[model samples]
Target: MIRGQCLITNKDDQYNDPDVAVILGSDKNPTCESQSVLMAPKIKLSSGYDMPILGFGTYNLNGYQCLTAIHSAVESGYRHFDTAFNHENERQIGEALRTQIQMGNVSRENIFLTTKLWNIHHDPRDVRRICEHQLNLLGFEYIDLYLMQFPVGYRHMCDEILTPINDISVLTTDVDYVDTWRAMEELVKLGLVRSIGLSNFNMEQIQRIIQCSSSKPVVNQIEIWPGFMQKDLVDYCRYNGIVVTAFAPLGQPNREKHTPIYFFSEGMKRLVKKYKRSAAQIVLRYLVDYGVIPIPKAGNPLHIKENLKIFDFKLEEIDIRALRGIKSKERLVQYENIKNHKFYPFERED
Candidate 1:
């Protein structure tokens, strides 16, 4: 059974170091920042599990880099990890986590690990097979949370081919997501996963699932940042008791020529100076305060430590108002390839 209580700390007890020098020191002495790093508080999921509000995202990380980043994140006091089978790094993640467990750094019970079921495996028959394969890759008894990767389904060419395509576009399957959700609920009953949820699914899709399934989704993972808050959808999910996990919470500032305007806006600059925090830190804190878990991916050691420090401070109401008022309505992660599918969640862009 997954068990734990939320670790509530006073706002004044937050670590105040702006440089994060203590947490970024040499790995030889791992205990240097043990007491300095503030552990993130946990939010109870409807599935009866406690998930840390700030999670580590492993989307593009692979091989040695992936392993090293996980170690760094663990050292920086991160307890929640987000990955997908399509991310293609579960094997390395499992190895890194197993190493940590062997070294007595963290236990399985305390770590909240979340992975997704790929669209190709949406057929109810293939769901269990793919989940078990993922377990073998992860080398875990059961997953903490397993999310339906998207509302749409894709053709199953083979186990290795994640995105099977043809001359027309990506080949989509006729499998209904409700059927996929039913198969996922079976996973919970069979002890393959502790909790089940949805990802990249819009409000209408989520409503359909709620109407049909006996086990309601505890989470809806999606893209959320200052630029595109998806207010109505977020409000709908919250009203239905579904927790939102924000991916790309920093707005992918590294994207060439497409840097999020908020990153350089004078308003954001003022808030950064006022709080003595980085732009990334301010946005992350704002999202958390806005009531969602932000899983920002960082391979750099300094960034890993910096991301974890947001738990120490609370964003003021006026600052929150300023952030919410940002007018840019750009959505960063549009899965354009599958947009033509009948169940494509987002509105078709011209």
Candidate 2:
């Protein structure tokens, strides 16, 4: 039995009870065996659905590589997958998932699929049309979770042009995000999507939607890592019953030549040695303990399996404090092209 006192029956059932906890077994081994596959703990969303606490991100993954990665991820016991319309690999992801289901590896009801509505389709009138198109591409009956990609809206030059640019900057539109959210609420009523959410949105923007719309967002996907822990935003979302989904939880790769020194701090080194885990596993486990669902992307099959092995261990309070104490703060996924948009969510550096 797992350590936590709470018991959860019917692993696939969505419950409103706050007392249920889905704790994993106490096996610390990371081997990839049939009996050793770990089921990730599920967090209850305000939408009355259960989401796995960790997911596999599909950004920049396409063609044969995307299919192979999805196969490896399913074999590794990953039930949740994160993808975006802008990522342009929905068809391949859909096919990979179909093949898995046909092979008796997994079922649709056991999987959680999350996709985003791009900035260009933020107009309320265009929201459903684009969502339908995405569904057609993915060959799904309904999306598990649909997210507004960003607070900022862009000019819709055409369906083909994802990012319409006016010389040096992205063309901006004044469509209110609240209206777009209202359209998403309609998707829930029409059985097109199970839950709706926000991505790259600040607290103020989220509050505005809450004030204006009858439906509330259940999740907020954003960039979070050890060095750039947005404590305030994370806390605020948790307080409001909105689960935070972390993208780039292990931080962006190859963009920066050298890893930040904080990643190799004495505290982290000690934890790595003590846990017999890699630095990436430590960082991912730390984020899960901090109360956010991390979606880390990896191309290598070994690395993909390694990412799922984090649920076996729990971080100590002192170790969590040591990670929180790191002084470096950097935002890696800044959409600099949309910085000047009226609805841009991040702070503008002058």
lDDT of 1: 0.85
Residue runs of model 2 more than 4 Å from their true location after superposition: 1-36, 264-267
Task: Give candidate 1's TM-score.
Answer: 0.90
Candidate 1 displacement at residue 246 in angstroms = 0.4
lDDT per residue as tens, model 1, 97-132? 878777766678877899999999999999999999
The lDDT for every candidate, in the order shown, is 0.85, 0.84
lDDT of 2 by residue, 1-350 (tens): 11112224434443334533453322232223324356577877898988988899999999999999998888777879999999999999999987877776667877799999998998889999999999998889999999999998889998889899878888889999999999999999999999999999999999999999998899999999988889899999999999999998977645356466666667767999999998889999998878899999988999998998886677788888888888867798898988887888999999
Angstrom error of the Cα, residue 15, model 1: value is: 16
- The CA lDDT at 328 in model 2 is 63
Q: In candidate 1, what residue range of length 10 has the lowest lDDT sum?
A: 18-27
